[model samples]
Target: MFITSENATPVFKDLTLVMPAVAVGNVGQLAVDLLISTFNLPRVGYLHTDCLIPMAGNNPYATGKDDAGELHTAAEVYTAPELKLAVLQIRAPVVKSKSRRFRQLLLSWIKASGFSRTLVLSSSHAYQRDDQQLQGTPLRYLVTPSLLKTSGDAFKELGWREMEKRAPLCPERLDTGAEEERLYVPGGGITKGLYMDSCTEDVPLAVLLVFCSEGDNVPDAMALVSHLDDWLHLLDNPNREGKWKIPTSWNLLFGSGIPPAIF
Candidate 1:
């Protein structure tokens, strides 16, 4: 599971799982381990965009939306179009800005490869499931629930008052800096930088595996897809006023269809 520089290449027999950071390498090291060790999946390819180009190491964290690095070349050997499916672990909405270009290129390659079944894996916001409200009203702190949950401590370590752990006995949720005026202290705790967090973990893997079974029970796959889409839509729309709800057409997009070939 600890795929160090020594033994980084291995051929998978059935399916190929692709994620953006898995290409740059270090960023999704843990995730790659989970996919390979936990699920026994193989590394087929990766995406390396411009942001990832500069910091490109053997396998660095994903800083861009479209850099395939060695994966582009490895595609033919590792990612065969005839494979059963391709699992793309990209939590949508969170990467909406960068994902557009990334997805475009991925879809293009898929079309070229002629692969029919593709699963776009994503996780919902943790806040949506936990029902946790934003500690303060700040435009910058507005993030998906999954991001917050996955990145539990990074936010606090960054010294953002909004994420600071208040006194356990008398917890006071700090507002986005604008609310700091309420506390007459200067520099009490405020550091600034891009705050990125990913908290959700349940939905996608489960959904993906249901299909990975790849059995004749197509109805089971159909049901799981329906369940997943329903959850995602509910998280996408958080209504503070009314009871949260998923859209009616959650299953319209999924079924037994083959994945888009990205080989």
Candidate 2:
């Protein structure tokens, strides 16, 4: 099941961006909304979408008819000339039957608008653990920091927000803070990791920053958004060591237009 809705657009300086909540989770939309709201940037567009699928291994939505009768909703388009950035949210349940169709729709919009690069905000678990391997080994978190960098008239700030916060969640230790620790477990213990079940603002910011900067150096990109996440993870935890290879400076190339200050 997939769904979409609309939110009001904003106004940011000369740059008006369209933020879309494509799937259920609106992290992408939330990130852009925060950026625009915080910086008072222009917003050209806002769209929201969602999805639903049979998870009990049986299509209860299906009647006595087509078992393959999956819900593939229609695609939507948000257009604007001043559109500098677009945020897309992909959730657990998309109209698999319409995945290709929706992808085509999104691609068509990007191509028609002459966007340099599409800043894809992919969910962390989607890359590491699909439906087939949901309860398998813990995923190794990684990212291409190279696709992030920007400065000058318009800049990109990249990073993830602390989605899961420490709260009085457990009833067993309602009054005892000693027994309750800030654990990163989303679903029991299998899906445990800093970003295993959560999406970060950094994902979108990194991609957008890169596209905005015309592919600048990765370190410079890291410098922009790296601090956004800060040191949320502590040592001795599985998150203390992720397999994401931080791109070296040699692996990145800066455009001549990039400021010397960034170097």
Candidate 1 per-residue C-alpha lDDT over 1-263 given as tens digits, one digit per residue, 9 for 90 to 100: 11212245433323433332221111122232223222323344444443222232222222244531423211112232333434343221223345345434544554444432223222212132211223432111222353346543654554432322222222355444323422111111111101121112111111111111212323332333333334323223242222222222122324545667854
Per-residue CA lDDT of candidate 2, range 143-217, in tens?
222223322112222233222323445656577654564533222111122122112312212221111111222
> Best by TM-score, which number?
2
Cα distance off (Å), candidate 2, residue 84: 5.0
Candidate 1 minimal-lDDT segment of 10 residues: 185-194
Stretches of candidate 2 off by over 4 Å are 1-26, 43-94, 126-263
Off by over 4 Å in 1: 1-32, 38-48, 51-98, 129-263
